[model samples]
Target: MDRPEKLLTTAQAAEHLGISRGTLARYARDGLLKPTLKLPTGHLRWSLEDLRRQMRELREQGGE
Candidate 1:
C-alpha cells in the first residue's frame, strides 16, 4: 500500500504554494482548490501532492 501523504495546515500550505492565507481561502471558496481533508471541527488540511496538482491545472489554464 502507498504511504499516507503529509498533510499541511493552512498557513503552511499557503507558504508552500507562495500565496497568502487569504488567497488560499479564496481559492477554496472560488472552487479553484479543495482540501485533502476537512476535520469535524471544520479545520482544513491539504496534501502536498494535491496542492501541486492544483497548481499544475491552474498553470495549464493560465489561471496562476
Candidate 2:
C-alpha cells in the first residue's frame, strides 16, 4: 500500500512558501500556483510536492 501525498491548506502552503496568505491566494488566482483540491466549504488545498516543485522552478528562474 502506498501513502497518500501530503496536502496543505492555504495558510500552511503560504507559510511553507514563506509568503503571505493573500499572496498565495493571488498566485492561485493568477494561475501561477494551482490548487490540488477545493473542498465543498470553498477552501483550497495544495500538494506539498507540487509546492516544492514550484518553489524550485521559481528559484531557478530568479523569481522571488
Best by lDDT: 1
Candidate 1: TM-score?
0.84
Off by over 4 Å in 1: none
TM agreement with the true structure for every prediction? 0.84, 0.77
Q: In candidate 1, what are the lDDT values of residues 1-64, reduced to their tens digit? A: 9988789988899999888988988888788888899899977899978888987998899895
Full-model lDDT, candidate 1: 0.87
The CA lDDT of each predicted structure is 0.87, 0.86
Q: Distance from true position, residue 22, model 2, in Å? A: 1.0
Across 1-64, the per-residue lDDT of candidate 2 in tens digits comes to: 9999889999998898788999988877887777899899989999978888887887798876
Tell me how far the alpha carbon of residue 62 in candidate 1 is from the true structure, in angstroms, after superposition. 2.7
Q: After superposition, how far is residue 53 of candidate 1 from its true place, in Å?
A: 0.8
